[model samples]
Target chain A: MIDEHLLDDLALQNGLLEVDAKLKLAVGIGAILIGVFSPSPVAPLVIAASMAVCTIVFAGIPARVYAALLAIPVTFVSMSIIVILFMTGGGEPLWDVHVLGYTFTLTTDSANLAVLLLSRTLGGMCSLFFIALTTPMVDIFSVMNRLRLPDEFVDLSMLIYRNIFVLIGESIAIHNAQVMRNGYSTFRRSIDAFAMLAGMLFVRAWEKGEEMLVAMDARCYDGKFQMIEEERRISATGIATATGYLCACAGLAVLFRSFRIF
Target chain B: MHIMEGFLPSPWWQIWFIVAIPFLVLGLYQLKKLFAEKRETIPLLAVAGAFVFVLSSLKLPSVNGSCSHPTGTGLSAILFGPFITSILALIVLLYQAIFLAHGGLTTLGANVFSMGISGPIVAYALYVAGKKASLNTFVNVFIAATVADLFTYVVTAGQLALAFPAPAAQGGLLGSFSAFLVIFALTQVPLAIIEGVIIALVFKYIIDVRPDILVKLNVLTQNTVNRIREAAS
Candidate 1:
């Protein structure tokens, strides 16, 4: 429930909501691939910056929410890159760190690797967030079906997607009840409370599952779930802008492959 | 430890994608067979998956005065068996990636391999072994959960080390492996223990409330169910 409203709610309300899903998908997936494949940090940094603009401005997602979301991956990537910086060595030493009986130096090569890794993480995450904040799972599921994925898989996924909100709401209610009673006042009590929540949630989910089956059987369900495709034609200008941005990023990557920040 | 997007570089991510596909197909195959035999289980499985998703989002209080999230693989593997759990894990990982930004699409394969496939396999195997040995059920579940959680992180560390080895003179793969392990395993051990305790408690509570479900699913034998009932009484 902590993140209950932030994801799909924003996507549903995005400025790009009425735009063609395929174009958005292409932009997102293509940017991700190009970002990940880029060798130098410059292209990835550029990709990340542009994605921020697209997600924040074009998609009309809240800047504060976007920054908070970016923080999660940035924190993780920064911590891991520190490990890379300390462990690898080559070229001129940039900084020396000593721990226990050994000295670890951050060398030029390691620094470059760290920057590359960080930039890639930023670029990839921004592109990913762009897709996530713009395209909802329903659109992706419909896309999956159109791609000729197995019907059973797609159907199960739709069911799962529908159920996730149910379970999230259920768990939140349970947690609120527990909090009211001080169920988590202590470490031991918190564990007990959480386990109890999980147990109760599982039982309820099982019952819901059974209820769903009965309802489906009552309707005489066959294997088909109707997924409608909205006719939102892709505009030529949209195509031009997307390709222009992607090509600019790709060209920057090729041009800056040998450029080093440090 | 869901690897961040583009963290594994090119070759490693593709390699993991290749490795994770067979398990996905196998899970799908098992799911289809289950659907044919029992259509009701399909909805149950779907709901159970969402249940896992919510379960993992929970912040479990640990003994070390810190809170962490559960992987949900241990309980799921026991309840649904490993193959189906893999599919559930894959979906859960995808949701975590999309909604939570915990993992990403390109690294989805790597994340699936570590959290979904490896953790569940370890948990299911250990649980089977414990049952075969007639080990104490609660204790067995605890151990299985902890070890499986730890092993998933270890595999992740190995994957990272393989992708980015240190200088050969500084011990290369082995060197970076331990470094990443230090970063993950240190904070993870206590968290893993907390996950284990919670998982066991969840299992115990399930047996207490709806022992019939476990018995019918063949997760617990009649003898074991009787033993649990007798012990409870």
Candidate 2:
């Protein structure tokens, strides 16, 4: 599994540091909307390709990291698309088979639907990757706050975000201790070890919550947490460039659809 | 079991988001009420949220040689009610989407509905039923966790089937749902069983060490606790 904490930290230090966080967010969301609404695969394919280039070239994210980030979703999407491919029948069969009194066939319509779904999914993923790889969670949360989400909801999210790392650290420590004692040498032992770890973690979590509350009380914490907001000004040049690029992509997709250029 | 980013088309994703909003609103209301009543609930819910995140992310070894991760929502549903679990599920799902890319922003609604709402509702119902029927604590926890996990996947399969029905099947939605359910069941069944056992043992340990906490959480009544202690002894 990828260490997302490390990835987010790395993203904070990457080349897209100068761009406005909101602009990056807008670009990501815009790409997804376009990918979803476009009539043909042309728009999605183009969006995905361009986003990949921007991430690898402009954002300076490592190609390997980008590929690794995509690998899991790609595998999942492929599995489901394969099911889609096999399940749709009754048209011109590219391949056909009979099993247990049922005809299993891959048809033109199924192939088309599979391709569309794959392109749309990939396009959307690329857009999300651009945002996730370029921006950090704090900025995203700040954006949510700026969007006027309820104070309570944003505050709770912030608290959970901060504590996730703490709990993960504690879990790792407990897991390591158990492993050193050969707690997972056998299947039964593994189950026992896991259960103990879970039980301990639960107890520890409750204690930690109490400790945090006491500490907060000591510091005169009221019900709501105060967050410091950083000023981020959007640039006209960046917005213009993003708009032009999106429009050009849309125009190309329209042309492709009209000309039937697969 | 997350529905990956952009997996559902426009209308389907929108419909799910609309369906999920009411549950989320109710959860927020419940959370506010809990916080007002007990100030400690703030930290408890925060830590519970983190617990769900960490626990769900752990890759456990399954009997089928494929790795499986427990949802961890069943335990939370038993401790907190289903409504609060929905709020935690939203946070966990959002975190996974933004940081881990496991699920998507657009598809968050579908994932939350399956993993957060439907699964926890079923788990909480099973738990309440078990308590009413005076079932053994271990058996009750096991059934709730296992069935909750299975139900999450079942709902996920149903969502997928609804989005893309099988062309070959004459039964339309039902047929497509069965196909997806069967595919998921091959792996999800054994994984659910393993998760159930793990959660049961963990609950048993918690009961043994600190029955007070469970009682404090209102998860176990005094009579039930006495029965459990007697059964253990």
Candidate 3:
């Protein structure tokens, strides 16, 4: 979702705005449809398949990169499934394990449910991953601003997006320093390093906040972070293309609603 | 609770969402005033948001296999009052819904109202009580945590009651609420404790190191709070 180098390169290149707008429209429409239409089992599968096609078509990155990105939410889904399967004990137990005077039953329904839930979540994540991969981060901020999000929130997001790379670098450097001092091979040391990292981040962020405030004041900063909102004329061809894609999605949604596919 | 799509009846969720939109717009408009007055506060809000997002990504074991992240509602409430915290929470929830999928659009309202409004109000009230009683910081935090956790559950219960039909055995409002509480309690109590501890530590550290941060954040007034402390002591 956050590729700093790609974002910087795209921002440098001219004609990126038009590309971003079109991609934004496609992603916006798709996300809305997914949110509204894909409420059941079959729709999620269909969405997943469509997302797979979109990933292949739109994502310039390799399949492995996509898979690595998709692994994040996939892992989360797996954890949820495992927890739910063990806890939700009902419907003709497939297997029962007695542990410490407690009977843990795993049912066929639970297993099926875990798969269903995992697939649905993975489908959503994959679709989102592709959307983020295709759309640059700065363009997303522009879209959010254009979509009438509050200026403060938009500005906040932009700043966070901008500084995230710097912060991540700083965090990595700090981690390396800590590791060099004493290797965090032990579990306790690893946790201690994490806690130290968090505390350091907090302090750094706080100091940065003060410095940023002072810098803004020094620069004769007004309260609002103003960016020129360029008015772009929407070409008829672009509108037509976007409309066609939107109508197809709407059609799919209507068809699914009528048939109760998901 | 991160309500999934289609979990609630479409009509009900749609209705609340519709109702929520106007409040959201109105709230945003009202927030415009605050933005112009104190632009520096934006970074503070951003820091709070970024910290919450970063810390939340680090999931800690709570109960069983269900993990819960720090809501940071108490801290937000302590710094900014509940009213502003509501708007901040809504914005954060919007980002989370659109970007992370941690929470859903339909359920954002209920989540905001619970974590944003109820948690802080309860925490602040507890803090006030603790102040009056001259209680220690840890005691104040524990009280705040317990009250805030209970308050959110109660509000969530009401929401469940509204969403589901009545009668305990029918697997409707009461039954669902009970089931949710039982499931939620497994993680929520521990999550609350973690949050309480973090907030307390942050509060203590801020008081010692950079009291100016809290002062600028409007969490505590310099002279008034000092006077109160001196008198209490």
Candidate 4:
């Protein structure tokens, strides 16, 4: 079902922010309710399917790229489940495999458990991804501010986001510097190199902090952060959509629970 | 831990949302303090940028083919303090949530609580504790790094417990905690050590070469001898 049509939809847009914010508020509440009240099997798949559909329709990204991006965590979750399922010591053992002083037994429940976990994780990630990809950063912060979060929290979040890239660049430089000088191609050498990299990164960060403090004091700063714009209010339509989506998700979860389908 | 959708009972997540709202509001209000006197924090911003960027590249080894990265809020906490650091952490989490999918939008509150708030507070607390006792700078940073990592993992464990409850009451909590602890122990210890060493070395070099800058940031005092004694003692 993963197709190429969705691939072209990944482009960023002005409306994407509204769509994403609305979806997130809706999905976040909905998912939690479902997690608590809904039954298994059907509930998990339905949730996953709905998210998949959203990713395809609203994410504005190619389906393949979406899949690829999702694969990183999904793969980890799936593998963990697989290892857990087969290695677990319950249910009818299909076979026993001994490796590295450990015995792994495969069972039906384990397989079922694995599938269930993977499906839930993938579905959840994809849905959340859809919202993030669609929404612009500033607007999301605005929405949080509107939602009644403190101004400091919002501003700090902005600062953190701004600095992340800079920090990553410094980390890479330290890493590269280690590689060039230490030649950490071997396991032990790599560990030493890694230690050195960590050491260098911290030293650089502290120095940068010192320089930053001087700059701030020179400008007469005293621990206050201010943003340039006014906060945006949530529209009625946005509120309505969020409410309706949440209600539907809750209703569906309740319905599934009543049916007792696990 | 990023709680996937439909994992925790809805009520729990809602409660977290509620708890987070006020803290967030208070944080916003305090933000003015970070720049109250119309001071330029561009230098701090630059440092923040560099710190986060470098942290991103240092991956922790975990389950096969998987790795977890330190939130790195500990160092941020020490330099920027918690209130500002929390918000900054939120921003970092937000970007990662969108571009890298390392976190999710819905779980932003939880992530903020863990990496943003708790991590830095623990780190800062350790720094204060060390300072009170007159421990060497390296010892202080190392202990802070270690404790911060442990506390962050504990917070992560609490979050995961919300997401997936243990099937049985007696053994479930222990099982879940152990599962996560095992994974964290495999990865976080080395990361903390590295981070601690990094902070100490950097702080030392800064003191030696750029005493004025440190004093400006309030990291070091205008009296150089006192600062050295502070570090040494």
Best by TM-score: 1
User: Which residue runs of candidate 1 sit more than 4 Å off their true CA positions?
Assistant: A1-6, B62-67
How do all models score by TM-score?
0.97, 0.94, 0.72, 0.70
Model 2 lDDT per residue over A1-262, tens place: 2144445766788799768889999889888887877667788889999999999999899898888888758646766787778775555778887879987778877777787788888899999888888888888888888899876678788888888888888888999998899988998999888888888888888888889989888988677887787887888999999999878777866776632222
- How would the docking of model 4 be graded? acceptable
Docking class of 2: medium
What are the per-model DockQ values? 0.72, 0.60, 0.18, 0.25
Q: After superposing candidate 3 on the true structure, give the runs of residues whose Cα lies further than 4 Å from its correct spot.
A: A1-18, A22-31, A34-41, A61-127, A163-200, A228-242, A256-262, B4-9, B15-30, B61-68, B97-101, B104-107, B145-168, B221-233
In order, what lDDT does every prediction score?
Answer: 0.86, 0.84, 0.57, 0.58
A1-262 per-residue lDDT for model 3 (tens digits) = 0221222332233233345454554654464445344444455566666665665554445566555555444333443345456554445668877878966567765565555555456555555544544555555666787788767667767655544444555566777887788736664465455555555656677777677778778988665577765455667776676666556555655565533211
lDDT of 4 by residue, A1-262 (tens): 0111211124345234445454564565465445445544556566667766665665545567766776656533543454345433335656677868865556555555555555556556665665555655655666676687654445556555545545556766666776677546665565455555555655565566566667657777544454454435567776786677666666766665544212
Q: What are the root-mean-square deviations of the candidates from the true structure over C-alphas?
A: 1.5, 2.1, 6.0, 6.6
Error of 2 at B120 (Å): 0.3
Judged by DockQ cut-offs, the docking class of candidate 1 is medium
- Top candidate (DockQ): 1
Report the TM-score for the A-chain of model 4: 0.69
Ranked by TM-score, top first: 1, 2, 3, 4
Any residue pairs clashing in model 3, and if so which?
A40-A262
